[model samples]
Target: MSGTPDGQGLAPRTTPPSITQRHTALGIEGPGAPLADYRAAFQAARLAMAVVNRDGLVLDANPALGALLGTDPARLADRSAADLAGLREDPAQWAAYLAVLRGERPRMRCTRPLPPVAGAPRWAEISVERTADGRGVLLCLTDVTERADLQARLRHLEMHDPVTRLPNRSLFFERLAGALEQAGRARGGARIGLCYLDLDGFKAVNDTLGHRVGDRLLGAVAGRLTECAAPGGHLVARLGGDEFALLVEDSRGTDQLCELAERVLAALQRPFDLGGQRMSLSASIGLVERPAAETHATWLMQAADTTLYWAKADGRARWTLFDPERNAHRMTRQALSSTLRPALERGEFVLDYQPLVGLVDGVVHGVEALVRWQHPQFGRLSPNRFISLAEENGAIVPLGRWVLEAACRQGRRWQLAHPANPLVVSVNVAVRQVWDSDLVADVAAILARTGLPPRLLQLELTESAVMGSAGRPLEALQQLSDMGVAIAIDDFGTGYSNLAYLSRLPVSTLKLDGSFVRGFRAGEQPNPADQTIVEALVELAHRLGLTVTAECVESAEQADRLARIGCDTGQGWFYSRPVSADRVSALVGGYAPAPAVGSG
Candidate 1:
């Protein structure tokens, strides 16, 4: 009667007759008529009207009822009311239908389902009345199930994710409270275990394939999740934007909880065959198994959320359980993030330069400018300690600008000191540092402020930072390269390895990851495996006309192997660890070492 019936499977409204219209519609010649006459009038009304005996047997049914029940009037009288109507399928539906019959004495309207007149289901509004004569009751049923069902469906849609069709935030909490009580009465359980999962890299798919495809992918994921819970009575819910939660019953220990987490991880390993895009993404699950000591759903959810943050922070596509030490780390992270904005304002960030030596020449050809924080309270903090926190809290944008300026200024300083043996300063760029901020403007500003020659500044970005760049990021990188600022893909081979896309990026160098470089020293002699990997990487870069710099070169033997394998430059303790600007400057100014060339 109030809201529009959304076009879901539901009933439509039946027009009720006005007082004067009711007399005309039903043709009631009332005045002093016996109650049987009044009962007969109700039974004869245009709407489907019926009266049933208390034992739930059909006593009377009218012509309109025949249309609703998919039967002729002659056959309708022979069938039981519940059988012909849809009440036979669901017991609850049948019970509600019977409550309207017998002694019920008033106008009541409801969209009760009925068997099809043709092949379609009938939604009917059933109203009943008690006669004064008390001989029998007269019932009125008008079909409005369509409108009612639509209303119910609309309510469901409001509280559920369309992709997952699962209970969302509001509905999840509502169900969780009930589950907690049932879990509270467990035979010998300690506490409940809640696993929260957020898919890593889902946004890139959304951006690349558009929201329509993204929604379909989410639906596919939801189907898999429902199957994941089919084995056990776990309650899985979608908490929006690729985040899902599972509430496991009778979960007591970390082992039990982790078992479910592993199932989730394995289930997701299957490819999502999302149309043509053979996308393979993974999730980070955070586990918090409640102890007997804990209380309340709020605290339980907080534990799950905290653990989930660690999963993403430690590394994505993995799971981490809540531990006391993890809590300490989280608190420390929050404290650090709180100060980042103010730190930028107070100029608390500084740059330290580590030399990137040419492995063949044994010369410091470039210095990677690394950001460090001299926190007022936390003492000195490395970027590893606080950079991720800064990125998560949106402080990376301004903080990154400061680092770019400081690194460029330092490179300009070293360039002025040694004009002949000029050096390039490489700076690590965070993913967030490029998403919203204008890379070209930021680099141009730094170069302008520091008066650093364009070649002196080398921007180092990770593979994840560049793989998804298409529009603005692509254009920005091109602008910076055109402006003479060199770009290098830092941490090569450690990200979404779309090799077909690598050559198209506007960059001049690739830094072989330290992991592969360190593998060289794993055996008694230079690891032939590591040596071979380096050679392959060097050849790839050489073919692309991009210089290769192998990282973490520690010994002369290692350096010799790298150079023989075609590595032109290397950065490690062998060249120098990240050092003070003054120390780096001195080394760059008067250093002389012959280029190491020749087959090993």
Candidate 2:
């Protein structure tokens, strides 16, 4: 050992002192022979090791350390240990190394890149820990180049699609997340866009041809998409199967996205010659572009997906840009449809009745029961809002059942209150209800439970549903009619106006559609065509023993014309807008005859 000017020991030893000797020198006790074995093992070990003072200068280095750095063991002394492991190049790691050297930290570990050596690793994991003696720190340098390279290769394989050699969904989403974060912090109106594409009739190709051919086609499509995206340097990714997406970061606007979508569509239109098998194909693209700060990954992807479906639905082979209004409507419909069944069970549905007054007597002849949905989230929803959605999702059957029962119960209450003038309750029925449910049985059950006479209950169906009656529908209607329930054709002449066919069926009345009544103008320039049509329909209905009910009678003039045409009963705003059950009862209680029509 040699003494330095600062009174610290600086030594170059043939064999480094054992830990026991070092501890003993520091006034600690340990067995000597085992520590001697530890000292020898440190010198002969494969791991590179060094002992450095508090200043980060190497006091001593093992043979393994010298071999790793490609220098002699003696030359490593007095050298900066951080410089040896290349940690000095990184400020964070350099600070950490200094902290450990100054005894401020227990240990620090980091991986750093080293200058390439002919037969040595180019990366090292440097770990610095304070020695037990507290006089110095121990540094270990591990060669991690092999592990680093393995991890890099594995990451590459995981982030890329095996077939198209493009980034896979995992990597695409990762990049999208990063981009969104950056965009959120960016200034100005930085935006992002995505084009979600699916090959039309791809399944057909996979079915007719082998999957091998299908995969080849996908590869070809990916190549074309990559070429199209190359001009903008957009990232193209394969999102499984035949679906691909192009992510445009820092997008200019929707125009840029739309232009890219059009280019992709045009590119996919060309014929492909795959292994002597020729085929032509088209693609449908859904494009979404918005300010990156305003949207997230899931919402942006949903918009793109919905737009793509719209492209397909609007006859395919095209591109559709995201429309906020259309998307809102679709989302609302979805929300209503999903909640419809539960809403019925939750008793969120109620009925409002509109009085259908007699054109001759102006008496409150009957009331049309209209279903209203008192949705908690969306507030009150009229039938036009969710009825079609309910029909599509098969919720109409249960909902229709509810409407029938509720209407019947209310109609029975009115009948018991005023037996002398019991009003019929007419309920609108969806075509799906007729097919999907036992309509006749449901109506019978509802009437029987409510004690409402079948004569006081009428079921209104569209002409299309009633005209071509056959099989179950015809049988259901005939049975209900035989049970004394009146079957009236709602929206007459709007659908198949097979008037001759109505006589052969068990129909009792024809409620002409509001469109025909809308055509009946009140001025001197009255629509003669509309009047003639109504008159002829009324004459034919009266001759066939079917009552003619004109709908949408908004004014007394229109009502007078309808009554003069020999129309039986009328339903419209002229009588009243659809009102609550209490309001309908008030109208029924205060009935009066319509004023006589003068010959004009």
Candidate 3:
């Protein structure tokens, strides 16, 4: 009897026991006594068993062992037990078996694959233990082939998608993580690439043709994608809905990824015929490939998602590559949008005034109140960086109210300082301010708080926002105008250019867009078309009782050209760039006596 490593055994022996004594000590008894009972028990045992000497040579094997090996019991004698049990194929297990035979280890157990016998390969768990005499070892083998096959089937079902019969998102992510980790350990600049794809207008197909057809279309698309990716042996996965991803491990470079994307796009465009309901569809792909050492799974997927949006935005049936600079800009925009509401409360906003000088008199009559963000982390940012973002996120309502209140306060201060010639303060208003907020009440409240007359406060809106105003917006504009607040259309000629419709609305002034003003050349070869257009616009505005202002007047030459064309006021760098409040005050103080309101 062999003892386990835990210092326990069936029987203790001070000296080596004979075969009969060993059998009798194990409680085997019958009519034939020890040897006959031992032989009967060994042959009748269900588990395959063999006895080997210290040299690993099999001294004897039971009929059960012969049946497992597909051979005769006598033939197993004189054969190497390690070889018969397939332990010699694995060096570690062979070494462990040798250690057990040398009495260094009490026992050792391991699983190994057996060579084909009778055209049937088998896997078995083999156990080797030292005998009670410490002169030989007993080997036992157990078949586990069925268990291995069952586990493999379960793994396949777990990792694959049922619809497209491809890998699902779970397996895709697993493979991506593994590829990234392996690439990190690989040498020679190995990289990973991903093409994140989404079928364009796939929802419409489901809406009209039903989901069954949509599913079939998806299956066809998956087949095409697999065929396209087959050349590079990439992994194609269906990531829910119409979205799919192709993963390239050990990618060559951007060129390879781009080529694969182009191939996939071409393949998907060839009209998917789903049970005679033929339809043509396209896909947008976002491609990202980088050195695996520099990125991980989450960041890579995010980049791919963003790039896919770019592809759709740039028009579908195309692929866009990941751009770091663009990604940084988008990240900055998101950060600004998320922090905008809190930033207003933090007092990070301030106003800078640009002198809206009168083109005819060359006097500073008004100043446009431009808002600036004094961010703690990003420093100062101008309106172009965040105005639209604020509007989209609904932060503009509060931010706009703050700007109006602050500008009015400053306007009242200037009125007190220069009652003889008070400068009108102009502020830009986004369309959302009217629809999303109580513009009428907000303006009235700010006017009362700051004691700034509506006559000295002018509100500027883009032409597109004010042109087609109706419903609440139109009524709001009419009320603001009736309250004695001047309403001017900023960027006048850019949008809807409905000059004739201006007469039907309560508009007071037109601030020509910078593009039209930039067209006013000064040299010998001036742009005649631009000069004629500006002259006609100014004349028409004056006739309609609306003041005309020229924007982006950079040089004295351009200012002279605008003034000669009957433009009433000019706002540009020729007079001054947007400056601090203190700077605007100094300029106003140095000005000569002028009218209270020179022009719009």
The weakest ten consecutive residues by lDDT in model 3 span 591-600
- The C-alpha TM-scores of every prediction are 0.51, 0.85, 0.86
* RMSD vs true structure, all candidates: 15.0, 5.0, 5.8
RMSD, model 2, all Cα superposed? Answer: 5.0
Q: What TM-score would candidate 2 get against the native?
A: 0.85
- The order of the candidates by lDDT, greatest first, is 2, 3, 1
What candidate 2 gets wrong by more than 4 Å, as runs, is 1-51, 58-80, 88-95, 116-122, 184-189, 524-532, 589-600
RMSD of 1: 15.0
RMSD of 3: 5.8
lDDT of 2 by residue, 166-199 (tens): 9999999999999999988875688999999999
Judged by lDDT against the true structure, how good is candidate 1? Answer: 0.74
- lDDT for model 2, please: 0.87
lDDT by residue (tens digit), candidate 3, 373-472: 9999999999999999999999999999999999999999999988888999999999999999999999999999999999999999999999898899
Question: What's the CA error at residue 339 for candidate 1, in Å?
Answer: 2.5
* Model 1 / residue 475 / CA error / Å: 1.5
* Residue runs of model 1 more than 4 Å from their true location after superposition: 1-322, 496-499, 526-529, 592-599
